[model samples]
Target: MKSTLLSLLRTGEGEFVSGEKISDQLGCSRTAVWKHIDALRKEGYTVEAAPKKGYRLAGEPDTLSVHQLKSRLPEPSFVKDILHYPSIHSTQETAHLLASEQAEEGTIVLADEQTKGKGRLGRQWHSPPETGIWMSLILRPDIEVRSAPQLTLLTAVAVVRGIKESLGLDPEIKWPNDILFNGRKAAGILTEMQAEPDRVHAIIVGLGLNVNQDYFPDELADIATSLRLEKGEKVSRTDVLEAILKEWDWLYRMFLKEGFSSVKPLWEAHALTMGKEITARTPRETLKGVAVGIDDAGVLLLRTKDGKLHHIYSADIEV
Candidate 1:
């Protein structure tokens, strides 16, 4: 009922929607309409009501519904389209389909709740309702297929920078792309690419950020932490999302102008894995070494105890 009422209110686009019309459209009594309106106000919605003018949606709170998001971000930085869902199987799955259908570059898919959220290594990312930012971006950069991995690193730098500036809290990046605070996971990025031989097609970048969760499930309670838990107060998902998108637009423009070298140092500055001794587990074998740095190709440089430097393309790092 709130969804339907919200839709009707948005149809007005700041104009007043009469109580009689809303009741007729929703097939509810005038009193029921008033109750729903009051409920929305209690949830921090700004609704203006008058004797004869009926109700006007002044503004929405920090919810991530498409209407609120579109209204809050009146001018998009670089995003082409924003497709929002109340609940989805996976933003990445829907983005893959959209990209295949030639959706414009910078199309974003966002969900309030993901029933089957995905993580690295085929793990499930727990995304509770109204607690996090779950979104996927479709990017069609004109670069070689080998260079797509750098986009992940670039995104990492943007997330850490956005969080620091917006929330005034310190956060670090765990390569290839994980946002960490106080040695616990706060956010993760998954980058998937579709390419043709010797050319590139589209890259789908998925970001899951735990913002205001009060508690996690038993299994994730120890391994996962939300921005609220880390900061000891509630955090706004909309604010964080807006900051990240803006920073991403700026960094992405830099990458397109100067290439990955421009983003390389920025990523290194936020990386928590740099100059640390860790064990890296790849598909082939496991190696223990001190993390030196990343190459221009975005591969990890690990110096083993034998003074040998090896490029690690993919691995699970245990620090």
Candidate 2:
């Protein structure tokens, strides 16, 4: 309802939209229209109401909103739609359910906080309220199951470019998923799939980015960080998200048309793990080696101490 009301008001940009017209269009009472307008004001939007002229948008805040996000994108946006939640268990969880029910491709699930945020390898992602970008993008790509991990690399590049553009920060990709500044974690990508043996249904990519966190809990103090922590000031979450979405839209089209060949160099340029000796902890064994590079299929190629190259499909990388 909020989104619908926003759309109506936005159609008459730079002018007032009458309360009677809003109620008629929304199929609600005049009182309801005023209440919704008031709600928008409380969310930091400056909505000016007049006696007979009705209401108009006076200002917009540096916050997240479905209406604002949609306005930022191009018409017939590559993003099919974005489902926004102020707070939820996990955007990835909701994305999985939506994708399973045959949601359209390019749909995004966005949230301000996640009570039970998810991470890779059954880990819990810490998602504090209003301080991060917590969102999941659902993709139904025409690619084989073996090529899924490439999307993770693709997303990492998008995020790196996004942060660099938005905050003037040089963030690097810690192979497979994490984005880090210096050595502390700034963001992570968790990719989940609904697929068959040889086919694919949906790829839900969840990104948790620490945007304006002033401090971390004791456990995360040493290992975690945020853009604000690094920049000595606050940053807008919506600005970063908008930049990422634009980058993702461009890269996704290129990926679908060309393939990983185009994305390899971009990922490698921002990759922090490449050419470094690292320890990898997989489910079966622990291996120590120098991180070489990822293959065409997005598999990490590690050259161990004994001079043998190993194909690592899944692991926790310690650099």
Candidate 3:
């Protein structure tokens, strides 16, 4: 009911909607409308209330909520169910639990801040309050466990396309699942899966994007940056999230129909490590070589100095 009232105020277009009219439209008492308006004001929304004119929405807060995201999204089916939080230990953990309970494929777990966010190889991800995008997507793909790694590559393609479409900035994919901008880490993707020996149960793709953050910690100051820092202004998290979901829906559908071959070209076109001398670091050892390309199953290919080609299934690439 509060969400509906808020939506009505926003759609009022800067003109005051009379309290009687709002009550009539919402089928609620005038006092109930006043209470919701007060709540919106406390949530950082600049709602102006005039006794005779009623309430008008002057401004909105830079917060991510289910209602806010749904209002902005063009396609409703992409977000069947969204679990939003002001703070959480990890969206990934919550998403895994929801998936285990048979949540729909397009359900999302999103948060304003993550207390224990993580990236690939168990590295900590910095997710401050109300600054970046920290969310997890639950997907139940009908693919083999062997083909699950390709979903990471698919997510990278969707994120890059989303950033391009929303901000008009071209970011590069760093090997498996990192997005780089101007040689700095702008976003990270971590893909986790639950599978049997041959079939996949669910794949949770977690994305931590630096959207409107203005600063980072001393440790990340040298290597990390945000979209606001790159764009010279604050970018909308809602727009970025909407764009990514739309792109992911389209790309995932194409991948399901035509296989990974259909999406490989786009991933390679924006790949940053291709044709560059780099170091691939796995848990066992590190190898220095030139990145050639990805194979049919989305494994990276590297050519060593000794003219040997190595098919890297999992590693962190340093270019």
Q: Candidate 2 residues 1-319, lDDT tens each?
A: 9889888888878699998899999999999899999999898778889988898987665567678778887766679898889899999999999999999999999998899998898889999988899999999999999899999999999999988888888999998999999989999999889999999999999999998789999999999999999888778887888888888888899999999989999999999999999999988999999999998888899999899999999999999
Candidate 3 lDDT tens digits, 1-319: 7778888887799999889988998898999888888888898899998989998998887877578777766664556788999999999999999999999898899999999998878788999989989999999889988898899999999999999999998999998988999889999998999878888889999999999888889999989988889889888898888888878888898999899999999999999999999999977889999999999899999999999999999998899
Residues 143-194 of candidate 1: C-alpha lDDT, one tens digit per residue = 9988898999999888888898789888988888789887789999999988
TM-score of 2: 0.82
Candidates by lDDT, descending order = 2, 3, 1
Measured with C-alpha atoms, the lDDT of residue 100 in candidate 2 is 96
Q: lDDT for each of the candidates?
A: 0.89, 0.90, 0.89
Question: Where does model 3 exceed 4 Å of error?
Answer: 1-42, 45-60, 71-78
Candidates' TM-scores?
A: 0.82, 0.82, 0.83
Number of backbone-clashing residue pairs for each candidate, in the order shown: 0, 0, 0
Worst 10-residue lDDT window, candidate 3: 70-79
Say which candidate scores most in lDDT.
2
Question: Once model 1 is optimally superposed onto the true structure by TM-score, how far is the C-alpha of residue 86 displaced, in angstroms?
Answer: 0.5
Best by TM-score: 3
Model 2 residue pairs with clashes: none
